[model samples]
Target chain A: MDINRLERVSDFQWKILPQGKMQVPAIIFASENLIKEMDDKVYEQVTNVAMLPGIVNASYAMPDAHWGYGFPIGGVAAFDPQQGGVISAGGVGFDISCGVRTLHTGLKPEQVIEVQDELANMLYYKIPAGVGSTGLINLNNHEMNEMLTGGARWAVEQGYGLFKDLERIEEQGCIEGAEPDQVSDHAKKRQKHEMGTLGSGNHYLEVQRVVEIFDHEIAQTFGIKLNDIKVSIHCGSRGLGHQIGTEFLKKMLVNAKEYGINLPDRELACAPIHSNLGKNYLGAMRAAINCALANREIVTHLTREAFEQIFPGIELKLLYDVSHNICKPEQHLINGVSQELYVHRKGATRAYGPGHPSLPQDFQNSGQPVLIGGTMDTASYILAGTRESMQLAYGSACHGAGRCMSRRQATRQWQGNKLIQELAHQGIQIRSPSPRGVAEEAPGAYKDVSTVVEAADQAGLARMVAKLEPMICIKG
Target chain B: MPQPRWEHFEHQADIGIRGYGTDPATAFEQAALALTGIVTGLELVKDSEMTEITCEETELELLFVDWLNALIYQMAIKKMLFSRFKINISNGILTALAWGENVDITRHQPAVEIKGATYTELGVFQTENEWVAQCVVDV
Candidate 1:
C-alpha cells in the first residue's frame, strides 16, 4: 500500500481523508510494518466502502486487513437507516457467520499426548469434513426450517449439545429476526445433508495446548492455564450461506439502479436498509447465521463424543463462540448519544468490552473472549475486548493471520506431504483428506499471526490473554 | 490459433479463473472447467453422467456468474465433479450440459469446496480474435 496516500494518526493507526464520492474517512488499525505489507487493494476496497450510503463514522479495517471480494477482509462499518443507510451482501462475505469456537478439555498436554495419534484418528473418523462430506443426521424440510430459525438452541433440543452451552455463544445460540421463509428452497436443499460438516478451504478442527499466558487474570477468567488442552473448530454455514450470498449479491446488483445507488464496484452491490429487498436479505442472512450456529453446536457434540471414546467421561466445556462474518443490529454511542446501527464485520470479530449487558455474567469484568485462529503450524492467541476498543473500531478486532500469498503460489512453493512431515516433526500431527489442501494452507502462505495479534493489542483493538500452539489438526 | 483452455490466477485470499476461446460459449465452457479444477484435478473426473443447466441474465458478466454458480449448485446438491461443459448462450439465456461423475474422494483427492462466483475481477470481453471470461471464485 502507498503510505503517501494516508495520514499517520499513530504508530498503529493510519487514516485516509474523505475524497471524491466518499461519505466518510477510512481508518486502518495496524502497526507500521503490517500496514506496509497490506495489499494495495485493501486501500482501494476500504476507500470504496467509504462511498456507500449512510456509512457511520468512518470505514475501519482491522490489523489483519487484506484484499477480499467486495469490502476488504477485516473491514468494519456501521450504517443508520434514518440516513438512508444501505445493507450490502458483499459486506458480510460469502461465508456468512464463519467464526471460531474454543472448548476447554480439562486435561493436561501430557494426558493428550499419551493418546494423540488415536485421538486424531478418531476425530477424523467421527467429524464430517472436506468436499462431499455428509453428516449422519439429514434434515427434512420441516427440520430444516426449524434448524434455520432455532439455531444451536434447536441442536440442543435434538440431543446434540447441552443447554448451558448457549450462554457462552453470541445471541445465546439463536439470533432473532431469522425468517426461514425468506431463504430459498434451493438454499435449503444444499444444506440438507451438510449439517455438522466442516466445509473445505481454511476450515479445520484443531487440538491445541496453551503454551503461554499474557494476562494471568484474564486468562483465569477465560479458564486458561499453561499446558491445558483445548480444541478449536473453525467453519461456517456451509452451502446454505454461499447460496444466500450468491443469490443476494446478484439481486442487489440488479436492483441497485432502482434504489438510486451508484456502485463503484459491482461486488459492492447494496440496497436501502428500509427497502423490501434489504429487509428480505437481512431475514435470509440471519437464517444462514443460525445455520452456522447449529452446525458448530453439532460439531461440538461430535468432538465431545470423540473425546469420551478416548478418556471416558471427560468433560469439554464451552469457552466462547463468536462469528466474524456477519451484520448485526447493535447499539453504540454516536456523538454522546446511544443509537442502534447495523454493523457489518467481514472477516472481523466483534470485541464487546467489559460490563456490556450482552456478555455472560462470568465475563462481565473480563470482557468478551476474542478467539483468533492461526495456521496449522502457527500459534493461535486468545484476546479479550478492551474498553478502548469500543471507541476505536466499534469494538472490532482481527480474526486470523490474513493470507499473504495466494493458494497457487503456496502450492507451487511447497509440497503438501513435505509440509505435513515438517509439522509432524514440530510435534503437530495433521490428518487431512487431500495433500493438495495442506499445501494451499502452508503456514508460510500467511502473515505472522503473532505480529498481527501484537498490532491488535498495541492498537487497543483487543488485549492479548493467552497463546496456544496446535497439537493436532483435522483439516478439511 | 491458440487452443481453448483455462488457467488459474492469483488472488490474495481466493482464486481467480480465466478462460480463453474463439467465442463466448467456448470461453464460458472453459471457465466452468477452471471452476471444477479448483476443487479437484480435471483429468481425474470422468464424464460418466450428464446434467442440463439453464440460467439467464441480460448482462454478459452476470450471465457468466450465474453459469458458474449454477454449476456450483449442481455440484453441491448432486455431489458430483464435472470435467466437461458444453455451453450455448443466446439472447442472454444460457443452456448447457455438464458431464462428470459422483465425487470419489479417494480417487480425486479434492482440495477445496468452491463457495460461489463473485463479481470481483468479473468480465467477459473480446480482444482481437478471442473472447475471454474471467472472475474470482471464493473457495
Candidate 2:
C-alpha cells in the first residue's frame, strides 16, 4: 500500500485532505518514517471518521495509529453536542478504560535480581489472568455500587492503597455521574468475581528498571532515579466494561435512524450527543470507568502486599494511573476561552500539562506522567504532558506501539516458545500461562514504540522523562 | 453432504468466526449459529421460547454481526438464550428472527464472554455463487 501521499505538516506531523464523503480533514502525528510504515488504508479510515456526526477539529491518528474497528486504535476525536455530535461504541472500544498504571518501587533492579523469578511467579499467581480466569475479590451489588462511585478512593478507604495514590489517578479515580442502574445485570454478573484480576490479551504485570533519564529534574521529582525498580500494571474493567460497551453500541445502532445519522462506517455507529441515547451511554461509560478504576486499585493492593512480603518495609508509591479508552468532559482553551468539550480517546492517553488543575499538588509543577508501555523486550518510557498537547490533540498522545501485524499473522511468523527463549537469552524473564498468548503478542506484531514516543516528544505533544526496561515480565 | 465447520480467525488478541455456504441465507444462519456456539452452548437453550426478532442491515455481513451481537446482547442484558433463528438475506438486505428462552443463570453456566463485534477484518465478499462476509469480535 502506498502511504507517501500524505502531506507533511512538520518532521512529526502529517495531514490527509478531505476526500469523498469527508466532512473534515484527517490529521496524523507521526514522523515521515512512521507514516511510510503505516498501512495506506489508515487514510481511508481517518477520512471515514471525519464524516461522523459531531466530529471536531480533524480526526487524529497518533504515531502508533493502526486500523481498528471504526476509528484507528490510536485515534482521537471530539464532537460538539450543540452542533450534532454523536457517541459511538466503536469509538471507545470493547474494553472500556483499558489502561496502564505505573508504580515506583524504592528498591533498585540490582537489589532484586536474585529474587526475580520468585517475584514474577508470585505476581503471576496472585494476579488472575488469561481467558476465563476467575478472581479472588467477589463483591455483591451493594459493594459493586460503592466501587462504581468511589473508584480508587473506595479502595484506599478499604486499605487497598495509600491515600496519596488517589491524587495521581485520572478523574481522581472516580468519574462523576456514574449511574449503576445504567449498567445491565449481565455487566454486573461479569464483574462479580473479576475485580482485582488482570484479564488476558496484552495485559501484563511487569517489574521494570529505569535505565535512562532524559529529564533529570522531572525524573528526580517522580522518584525515578536510574536503575530504580518499578512495577507496571496494564488491564481494565474486564467483562463489566465489555458488557456496557456492547449493550450501548447495540442501542446506539438501533437508535441511529432516529437521530438521522448516516454512518460512514457501521462500526462508527452513533447517536446524537444531546439525545437520550448519548446521555445514557455517557453515564454507563462513566460507570465502567469507575469500575475500571476500582479494579486497578485493588490490583495495586495485591502488588503492594506481594512487595511487602519480599522487602518487609518497602513502599510502592504510585506514579500515575491513566485510562486509554474513554470519552470524557474536559475544559480546553478553544478560541482563547475554556470550553467544555467531550473528548473521545480510543486507545489513546490523556496527557494533561503541568499546572493543569486536574493534576495532584505534588505534580502541579510537573505535568501528568504519560506511561508508554512497550513489548516485554523493549523499553517503556515515562513522559510528561505538554501544553502543546492541549492545543494539538485534546491533551492526548499515543498509548503504545500499536500493532503492525494481526496476531494471526504474528503467530504464523514466529513461534511463542522460541520467542520466549530468545527473550530469556537476552536477559528478560517472561512468564505466562498460555504460550499461544505469548506468540500472539510477539514484539514484531507492534510498531517501534521508541519511534512513536519520539515523534510525540519531537512534535511537542509530550516530553520524555525516564526510560524503563523489563527485569521480569508477567504476561497475561 | 455435511457443511464445513466455520473457520475461526484471530486478530491481535481477539477472535473472529467465518463461514461460507451454498448461498447468502445459509451463510447468515451459520454465522449466527456459530456466534451462539462461541458465547455459550446453544443446546441448553430450548426452542420453546422462540420469539420473533426482525432487523434490517444494509449488507449481509454487517447484518450477520448485528444479528449475532443483538442475540448476545439479549442473552447478556436480558438473560435470554436462543435455540433457533429464521434469517433471510436478499440483495444486500438482511432480516432475522430468533427463538430462545429466559435463562436461569443459577441453573445454566456460561462458557465464554464475548466483548463486542469489532470492525477488524469486517468485510463482505462474493465467492462464485455464494456471498461471504468476515468479522472479528473482541471476545
Candidate 3:
C-alpha cells in the first residue's frame, strides 16, 4: 500500500524498486489521476508478481490496474524459460483469453438507423445471451476435440465464416499446441452446449458506430470509416478456460512447492516452464484459447446471420480479434538482443509493432489491431500496436476499462432495471436475463475506457485508430 | 426468510455461493446448486443424469474446494452434465457425491465449466441458528 516508494519517470510511468523478496521492480503506467484512484492492493499484487521466477524486465501494471486473484487484472509480465520462467494461473485470471473481437459492418450509421430496433431484436434472438445460454453447435467428444485444435479455422471449415476473415484474427484464429486430451472432459462438456453463446458477467456483444477516426489512413485501411457500424464481441473460453486455469493452478501450487519455488503471493502460484504440469497446462490453456476463438467465430457467424436478416446485402467483415488473457511465446528485443520469452498477459493484450512476422500481411504496416471494449453505454477504441510497446511493456497494453469496483458493490449501489432503462433512453438496447447482471456491469463501476486507451497511446504502448459507441448490446 | 434465496461471497479469485433451507438435507442440495452456479451457469444443464463422485481432502476447506472441484473436474474430463449433488462434510473431512450425465450434443444443451475452488477467504461454519459454509472458486 505504501506506493510512495515508487519512482515516477514521467506523467504516466512509475516504477517500484525491488526490495525484500522481490526479484524485479514493478512498473506501472497510469496517469496521475488514474493512479490516485487505484486500490492500494494493486501495488502489492504487482510486487508479488515481481517475485515470481524467471520474470523479465519490470512487472508492469497498466493504467487500469486493480487488485485481482494472483496477478493484478491490468498486469503484464514476461518470463524466460532458460532463466526458469514459470506460468501462473493467477496471471491468466479466471477467464482465459477473455478479450475483444471486432467485426466491421459495411454499413454507415444512416443504414442502421432505420431498422435499428429490428436489427437489435434479430441479433438478440440469433445470438444467445445471458447466464447459461447455449449456441447451435453441439459437439461430442471427438468433435469438441477437433474444435479445440482447429479454433476459428474449424468454424470456417464448417462454413461459419469466410476463410479470408481468418487473416484478421489474432494467431489467425488459433493458438498452436492445443491438446484436446489435456483438456478435461468437464471442460469439453462445459463447452459442448455453450459454443457460440455469450456467457454473462461482464461479457457482451456490442453493435457500435465509429464516432471518431484518429489515424485517417490507418483507420481507412482497417475499414474504420467514420459512422461505420462495427460489432464488438467480448468474452472468452468460458467454462472451459475457467476449468483449465483452475485445475492447473492447483497443480502449479503443488509443483511450485515441490520445486522449491518461493512466491511472494500464493495467488501467483506457478510451475517451471519445462515441467510436465507446465506443459500440460499450456497445452490445455491453448486448447481453451482455441475454444474462445471458435466461440467468437461462431458468435460472429450468428451476428452476420442476424444482420443479413435485417439488411440482406450488407457484409460484416472481421476487423480483428485479440485475447487479453493467457501466456504466449514471442520474440522480443530485450537488452539490445532478441530472445524468446513467455509473455503472460493477465488483463493485458499483445500489441505487436508494425513489422512482426505473426501479423497479417495487410496489417504489417498498420501494426496489429488492438480492440478495447468500453462499457455498454460508453465508447470502445481500436488502437494499433507501437514500437514503444516493445520497449515499454513487452508489447502489452490495457485490455479494457478495467473494473474499479466489485460486482457486489455495483449491485448494492445501483438497480439493474433502472440502469437498463437508462441505457435504453440513451439509444442503447440491452438484453439480459437478470437485472442484477445489469447493475453489476453499470458503466460507473469501471474506469472510462477512452481514458485508459488515451493513457496507453500517450505511454507509447499503442496508437489510437478509431472510437466506437454502442448502439445495441447483448449481455450474458 | 424465503429460504435466504442465495448466499454469495467473493474470496479473491473464487466466488462462493450458498443456498439455504430449513433442514440440512435441503441445505446440502441447495449448497450443491449454489456451487454449480459458481463454476458454470446452472441453466446450461437443462436435463441431467444420475452420476456419483467422491473425493477427500485433509481439511474441510480443502474438502469443500476439492469436492466442488471434483464435480467440475468430472464435468470437464467426462463431458458429463450433472444436475444433482449430495455432499456430507464433518470432522475435517468431506464426502461429496455428484449427479449429472453425458451431454447429448444433438440436443445442444451446454453446461458451463468451473475449474476449481480456491482457499481465498474460505469458510464453512454454523451460525447461531443455521449452518453456513462459504468459500470461493477460481472459475
Candidate 4:
C-alpha cells in the first residue's frame, strides 16, 4: 500500500508494477490517503496473488482492500484453466459465499419508527444467532443433501418463500455440479442444526431506510423510493462452510508442492484446475454456495414472518442477493477474446454491468444491485454495476468498509454499553446477544464507508445509486 | 510443574491464540483456554460437567489444530462452554477432557463465535524450558 512503490494511473487507480516473482502487475482502486491507511500486508498479499499461475490482467484490490490470510480482503483474481490456472481455498476465506441480501418492504420509514423497539426485540428473539445458536428447521440426512444440491430452491420447496423470490438470487438459487458426496460427513453434521441461523462475527440483519438517492433512474429500477424501509441480511453458509474450508485448506497445504506451486505463503494453499483436488474443491465450494443461498432464503422467510406478525398486509420482495466471498467460472474478454476463467472474489462483491447476460431481465437496463452493509451506526449504500466497472475491476467492487483497526483495539478503546447508548441517541436501535461483540464492531473501528464508496465510484468499480441509514440492527 | 498461561496476539483480522507452559500437554490445555476466552471469559464458565475428546494427527501442528477443532465441535453440538481442559498426548493421539456447563447467556457474554483454528501462523514446539502452542483462529 506504499504510495512510492505504486504508480498512480488516476486519482483513484494505482498500479504496483510486477517485480520479483510476480507474473502480473497488481492494481488497487483507492485514493492515496486510503492507500496510506491500508496495512502494508495488503501490498504483499495482492502481489503474491499475481504470482499464481495463469492469472489474467492483474490481482486487483477494491477500494476497501485490507490484509487477509492469502489474498487481501477485497482482492479479485481471474485464472485460466487451460493455462494451468489453479483454485485457492484461502482466496475464498472460511465463510464460503458470504454475501448480502436486501429485502424491500412496501412501507416507509415513518411506518416503522413508532414500533422500532418492538420489531428489534422480536427479530432478536426469532433469529437464532451467536455461538451455538440453532434454528427452528433441523436437517436430517436426506434434507442435508437436498439443501446442498437444491439451495434456495430447496428452501422454497420446504415452503420458506415464494417461487418469485428465486429470480433475484445469484445462480437462480442453486449452482449446478454441487456434488454433495464431495462434502464431508463432518461438514454435514455441523450444518444439521445451523440451517436458517445467522452465525456470529460481522453477520447482521439491519432495518434501513433509503435516505439519499444518487441516481434516480437506477434507484427506481432497483425498487427504491426515498425513505422506503428495507431489511438487509448479511451472512453465509455457517458451520458447513467453515468445516469445508478447514478440511480443504489443510489438504491443499500438504499438497501445494505436489502441484508444482511455489507458495509465497502457505496459507495460499491451492491446486491446479484440472487436478482431482481442484475439481473436488469446486464441487464442495459450489455446494457451499448453494448452502449460503438456501440459508439466506430461509432467513428471509423468517424476516417476512416477523413482519407479518407485527404489521399485517405487508409485502417483502427480494431486491438482490450477491456473494462477496466465492470462486465461480466466468467468461471475460481478455485481449479482445472471450475466454472462460475462474474468478475468485474474496471480500469483494460482483457487480454485473447493464446488459450482461448473467443479470436478470429486470436489471439488464439498470445493472445489478450491489448491496453494501456498513456498521449499525453508519450509512450503507446501494450501488449499480456499470459497463466501465466490468472492465475495470472484473465486474467487482468493495463489499463493505473494511476494518481499519483490529478487534482487540476496538474492544480496548470503547465500552460496549456506552457504545449502545450513543447509537441509541442517534436513533439506531441495536439488539445483540453480546455487548462485547458490539464494541468489537463499533463503526469507528472501520474505515469511512462513504469515502470507500467514493473511491469505488471514482475508480469506476461501481456506481452509487442510493444511500441507506440504519433504523434497527440485529447483531450476533 | 509450570503453570499454564494464555494470551492474545493481534492479527490484522481475526485473532492469534497463544499458550505457554513447561510441557506440551499443559501448553495444549492453555491453548484451549485461549480459544474459550475468545468467546467469553473462561472464569464465567462453571465446571459443572466434563466431556471427553480424542483425536489423532501425524504432525504435531496439525494435531494441535485437530485438538482445538474437536473441542469447538463439542462446544457447538453440546451447547457448552469449557474452562478447565486436561490434555494428554501419547502415541501420536491426543485425549482430553473439558469441564464446563451449558452456556448461561446471562453469565457468559461471548464476544464472537470462533469458526475454527487456521493453519496461519500455526506452531507447536518446545523452546528451552517453555513449550508453546499457538495459531490464528477464524471467528
Best by lDDT: 1
TM-score of every candidate:
0.99, 0.88, 0.88, 0.98
Report the Cα RMSD per candidate: 0.6, 5.1, 4.5, 1.4
Error of 4 at A367 (Å): 1.2
Q: Which has the better TM-score: candidate 1, or candidate 2? A: 1
Worst 10 residues of 1 chain A by lDDT: A1-10
DockQ, computed on Cα atoms, for candidate 2: 0.21
Q: Write the per-residue lDDT of candidate 2 for residues A1-476, one digit (tens) a residue.
A: 25567787888888888887777789999888888878766776778889987677789988888877778888898887778887787889889998999998888776788787777777776776654566787788998888887888888888778888888899888889998888888788878878887876678888999999999988877778988899999998888898888778767866788889887776787778788878888888888998899889989999888887778888898889999999987888767887677888998899888889998887888888999999888888889988888899988999998888876677679877898899888878888765656777788888888999999899877899988999888775
Q: Which scores better on TM-score, 2 or 3?
A: 3
- Per-residue alpha-carbon lDDT of candidate 4 for residues A1-476, written as tens digits (9 for 90 to 100): 56998998999999999999999999999999999999998999999999998899999999999878889999999999999999999999889999999999988887898889999988888888787688998888988999999999999999998799999998998899998999999899889889999888899999998999999999989989999999999999998898898889888888988888998987788888889999999999999999999999999999998898889878899999999999999999888899999999999999989999989999999989998878888889999999998788789999999999888898999988899989999899988888999998899889999999989988988899999999998888
Whose DockQ is greatest here?
A: 1
Better of 1 and 4 by lDDT: 1
lDDT of 4 at A187: 91
lDDT of 1 by residue, A338-439 (tens): 988999999999999999999999999999999999999999999999999998988999999999999999999999999999998988999999899999
Output the lDDT of residue A35, model 2.
85
**TM-score of chain A taken by itself, candidate 1:** 0.99
Query: What ranges in model 3 sit over 4 Å off?
Result: A1-3, B1-53, B70-86, B90-93, B97-116, B123-134, B137-139
Candidate 2, pairs of clashing residues:
A54-A85
Query: What is the interface root-mean-square deviation of candidate 1?
Result: 0.5
The clash numbers for all candidates, in the given order, read: 0, 1, 14, 0
Error of 3 at A467 (Å): 1.1
